[model samples]
Target: MRLRLLVIALLTVSFLGALDNTVVTTALATVAGQLGALEHMSWIVVGYTLASTVLLPVLGKLGDMIGPRPVFLSSLVVFMLASAACGFANSIWWLIASRVVQGMSSAGLQLMSQTIIAHATTPRQRPKYLAVIGAAFPVAILIGPLLGGLITDYWGWPWVFWVNLPVGLVALALASFAVPRIAGGGRARFDIAGTITLTVGLVALVLLAAAPGQGVMDLWMLALAVLALAAFFVVELRVAEPLVDLRHFANRTIGIGIAISAIVGVGLFSITAYLPTYFQMAYRTSATVSGLVPIATVFGMLVSNLGTGWLASRTGHYRPFPIVGTALGAAGLATMAALPVGLPLWVPMAVMAVVGLGTGAFMSLIVAVVQSAAPAGETGAVTSTVNLVRQIGSTLATAVIGGVIAAGVAALLPVGLNAATLTPQVVHAADPALQERIAQIYRDVFAPVFGFLAVTYLIGVVASVLMPRGRLSDSSDVVPAAESVTA
Candidate 1:
């Protein structure tokens, strides 16, 4: 009963965190107008996302040192407090600051939950459970925009922040009652320099990716980010209690698996993050209706994620799923890239379902593969690194894929047109002839973006193809095949 309750609480927290990550997006314009911070509106979401991304590895290390229960509880408190502050904020910068705190603490909730899940289940059982957690991300995304819009339209933008309070409090209470306390080790010490360098490096990189432009990053900022990352690598190698511990990568399976995870992240996030825009611009769907597009992806994730986990648990093999999933993901993306505009709505949804199924299967398998390979006490580190790579992947995808789309749209626009013409309001407000022309431009912009993503999926296919034909151990913490050999 405790275990079941614990898992449920953790899932709720994770689901809520994932929901928060996306929920505010639909409410951005409303927030700017109401708060009178129109100029700084983008920072509301950007600051939160930046803070969250930079802290994943740091919190994972904290969980390793001070125990996940304490870390999780602290994070919940911080997140709840910040959520309340967000609700009452009078200015845009104030709300953005509160969200930054919320984001950092929520990062703690996310990683600690994953770490707890890893510790809670055996290798064979791990995938099945993690798939449920993995499915939470897309599921939250499926619900976020519609929910955010409804709340903002009916009550107000403040309700968007208030929404997290109830869910946060409940998850906190259940977690306190149900989670077992696993205290930190006696000898663990934080690598402060490593953490600082890495965070700075990542923030710089993500900002460069996020810089406003088409198909370009600021050269000076890019240089600084590169230099910081290089310094981070050097620092990691020399530090006694290193942040990431590159030693783990000595295992071929783990090294390759992390690489594939990053690439898959590029493919997964590029679609999920931008496809809603495609719906609004090309199909002229309302914010609420545009959200429905991701439901197909969520459905695909539900089916394949659970199926992959159950199969791996039963059969004790994981390699085959990645091989098949990545190949199929490539195929699905290619088909979507080829699909012309104005088919039945189901056509794109069906393609998204295929892509989601493939990626879901990949998500299910990769967590187990890496966790299964972890040395008993350092599972947190390994899990953190995998997540770290994946986030960095999202960062790269957001920058590169976002840039590609912007560039594509810029190139396709009429002589007098600007990229702003594709905005939901702009597109909707235009004359019928202009709207159709813009919609055609949107279709053209997205086709190449889909093709670009298809190439990434193909890259994933190659990585999956090269995956060693190893099976997961069907027992708890028994040495994984790759780890046993390397160790």
Candidate 2:
């Protein structure tokens, strides 16, 4: 009863955080108008995302140090407070800053749920639980725009943030009552130096990815990000107990799994981040109506997740899924790429369904594989690392795509504007006519962006070759294989 209850509470919190991540997309324009930040609206999402990514690993480590109970509780409090701040924010900067805090706080919630789930369920039952938790992200992606649109249209943008308060309170209540207190028992001093270095490195890397072309920060920022990451690697290797256990990657299965997962992350998140833009630009649909497109993707995810879980249980084979799933993903992406500009709305929606199916079939499988390959105690570090790589992948996809959009916009600049002199902000701030011109340019430029997913999954295909062949039964974390590995 207690375990089940804890899982429910954790799932709720996970859904809330996941919902917050995507729910803002349709609301971005509304937020811009309200906050007078049309030029800087993307960061509202980017800042929260980057902060959440960087802190996930740190919070997981912290959970190992103190107890996940406290960390989780603290996260709820901080997240709620930040949400309130976001609701009442008077300026764009305040909203952005609150999102950063919310991001950092929510990191604990995300990691702890995974940690707790892994800890709570035996290997045999893990796949089902992972599915439940995994469902949150795709569901949120599906629901966010619809919910955000509804709230934004009726109540206003503030309600988007305000909506969290009541749900957060419920999560806090359930967590306090149901979740177990998990502590590391080790008295080793916290590796402050390593922590600081890695945090700096990750922040720099994510910021470099988020920076628009020739923003206030430029080449020097990129260089600094690289240097900090190098320093982080050095410090982690030398530390007696580093925050991120680099040793986990020494296992071939784990290392390859992380790489594949990261690539998957890049593909999945980029599609979610930009699909709305495609709808708005090409189809000329209202945000609410455009949101319905992702439903096809969500439906694909839902069916694939349930189906994959059943297949993994029956066939007892795991490797074939990722292998086949990536191929499907590549195919879907290629199909999407082939769609003509301003193609009928139904076409890309169909393509997105295929992409979601591929993603659903593969994603949780990777998480299960990586976790199963790692030792129990190292779960926090390993889980966080995989998620970190995924977040980095997400950041990279957005950055690269954003760069493409900027370059496309620059190339199509009208006769009066100087391409060399223009900043992204300047381009955005231009009159409605210029904005329309840029939008048309971006729509054309982004068509081939789907090909990037094809490339990403091609790498996944090669990585799948490196995957060990095992029946899902043998791969069972939830249940033992019907036939033994030795057999």
Candidate 3:
């Protein structure tokens, strides 16, 4: 009963985290138009991702030392408050600031949910819970954009953020009642040096990636990001209780899982971010209609996630799923890429559902593999690492594809347009002819950007080939809580 309650709490938390990502996608145009900063709108999404990526490992380790319950509750408080802040934001900067806090909260929610399930349930039960948690992501991903579109089109943009408040409060109330006070080792000493090094390195990398290639020609940003990452590695090797244990990568199955996660992240983020643009440009659909594609994807994920869990339980085998899933994911991506600019309206949506099916088939399988492979105490750290890679993958996709879009815009636009003039305010301030030119450039650039995403999915296909065959139920391997790094 306690475990069941924990599952319910985790599902709610997972939904909140996943919902935020897509909730703003459809509303971004409105936000930009209102704030008069269309050029920087991408950062609103990127900021949350960057914050979440940097903190995932640290938060996971924090959960292991202090216990997942308190950490989770604290994260919920921060997320809910940030949601309120976002709803009330008067400027883009305020919205970005609130998103940063929300992102950090997201990291905690994701890690704690995983840890809570791992600690409370046995391995056999994990697949079912994993299915539920896994479904939350695709479901939220699908709903966020559609909901954002509907709310923005009818009610207003603020409702996007406002919607989270009531849902978060309900989750908080349920968690308070359901969460256990499991005592563990007190708060472990955090690795300050490692934390700073990793944070700086990742932030630098993301910022550099976010910058339009034509805007600043500084290769130094790339160099600095590399240096910071190197420093993090050195600090981690020497720390007594490193936030991320490097030794875990020695496990082949775990390594494969992380690699696959990164590639999948890259593919997933690119598809979601760019698909709406495609629908708007190619199909000339309304924002609400464009947002419906995710619904199709999520519908597929919901079914496949449950099906994967059921199959794993019945067969006591898991490797074949990743192998088949990645292949299908790649095929779906390729199909998306091949879609003619004039393809039937429903074709893309169907393809997205196929892609989601592939995602559902493998999402939990990889997490389960990594968790099963890690020593018990280190589960949080290990789980965090895998998740971190995925976050990094998403960041990279956004940066790279977005950069490509920016570059394409710079080249294609008439001589008058620069970053400043591209702002929605500046664009509106310009003559109608210039606005037409800028709009054309945005449309022209997205096609190739989406093509690049397809390649990333193909890479996932190769990584899936490296996945190891294992079933948790078959092996009674009990990794103590102290040893499992929650990757």
Candidate 4:
């Protein structure tokens, strides 16, 4: 019963954090209109993403230094408060500021939830629980836009933020009772220099990827990211207690796990971000119906995630799941790339389900692999590092994919067909000939994007092939060192 409550609490928190990533997406237009900041609407989402991405490692390190429970609870409190602030904001800047704070707290919630689970469960038992927690993200992504649209339509756009208050309170209550107090590593000193350099690098890199226009600014951001990251590496090497221990990457299992995590991120985000747009533009589906299209993918993910977790936990050897998964994902993506736009919707849905099956296999296993190999004391840091890499991968891929679509549309669309104004309504209301041309443009543009995603999954297959084979440890409290874990 107690274990059930803990898992419930963790799942709720995970959903809350992940949901915010996409929930506001559908509400952006409503928000911009009401808040009178049409030009700055993107900042509402960008602010949250930036804060959360930059804070992952910082919060993870804090969890390792002072234990996860307190960090978890503190983050929940801040998240709830910021959620309220977001709901009540009368101006766009206020809402954006509140979202940034909410995002910072969300980083802690996301990182500590995983860390707490890692601390609470053994390697052998971790997969199943992590599987449950892992499902929250895709589930949240699946519902976020739909839910946001409903709330924005029925109540108001603010309700989207307000809704978190109730859910967060419930999670807080359960977590307060169910989470065990785990001790942290005794070290209290923080690597200020390392944090600064890393933050600078990550911010620059993320901005560069997410930047709207290209040229001089992009070059400057790239140079700044490169220099700051180089400095971060040097600082980590010299620091007594680094923010991110550079040595973890030297471990074969850890390295492979991180690599696969990034690839999975690229594949997952690139598909989810663009598919709805494709449906709306090509199929002329309603936003609500378009949002529902990914249900097939999420369903496949949930089924495979749970099954793989159960099987891995039972057998102890976990190496085969990702290998099989990545191959399936590659084939599925290749099929999707080749699919005709005129085909029945169910056909593409089926293909995405196959992609989801491949994705779900990796969701929990990579975390388990990394946590299993990390020192018990450094579990939080290592877990956060892997998650951070995944976030970076997703962010970069989404931006690149967006660029691909934008460039393709620009070249293909006739003169005066402004891409920015080509909403579903506009496309559907156009003359049949124009509609056909627009749909064809989407088909041509997205085919290559799908191909790019398939290539990523192929890379995942290679990484999975190189992964060191080993059985997960059975002891609940012991994390074997990297060398000891290798068979």
Specify the highest-TM-score model's number: 4
TM-scores, each model vs. reference: 0.91, 0.85, 0.83, 0.94
Q: Which ten residues in a row have the lowest lDDT in candidate 1?
A: 478-487
RMSD of each: 4.0, 5.6, 5.1, 3.6
* Model 2: worst 10 consecutive residues (lDDT sum): 478-487
| Candidate 4 Cα errors over 4 Å, as ranges | 284-286, 478-487
Candidate 3 Cα outliers beyond 4 Å, as residue runs: 28-43, 90-92, 149-159, 185-188, 214-218, 279-294, 405-455, 474-487
Tens digits of per-residue lDDT for model 4, 1-487: 6777888999999999889867888899999899899998988988888899999999888888887888999999999999999999999999999999998999999888888878777889888889989888878877888889899999999899999999999999999988878778868799999999999999999888877487898989999999999999999999999999989999999999999989777997666878889988877777767755688888888889989988888888889999999998999989987887767778888888998998899888789889989987888899899989999999988898899898898899999988887788998889989988888899889988889888999998999999998898888443221111201
Whole-model lDDT for model 3 versus the true structure?
0.76
Task: Report the C-alpha lDDT of model 2 over 128-195, residue by residue, as the tens digit.
Answer: 66777788887887678779989999999999999999999999899888776554535477778777
Clashing pairs in 4: none
* Candidate with the larger TM-score of 1 and 2: 1
lDDT, candidate 1, equals 0.80
Q: State the C-alpha lDDT per candidate.
A: 0.80, 0.76, 0.76, 0.87
Error of 4 at 292 (Å): 3.7
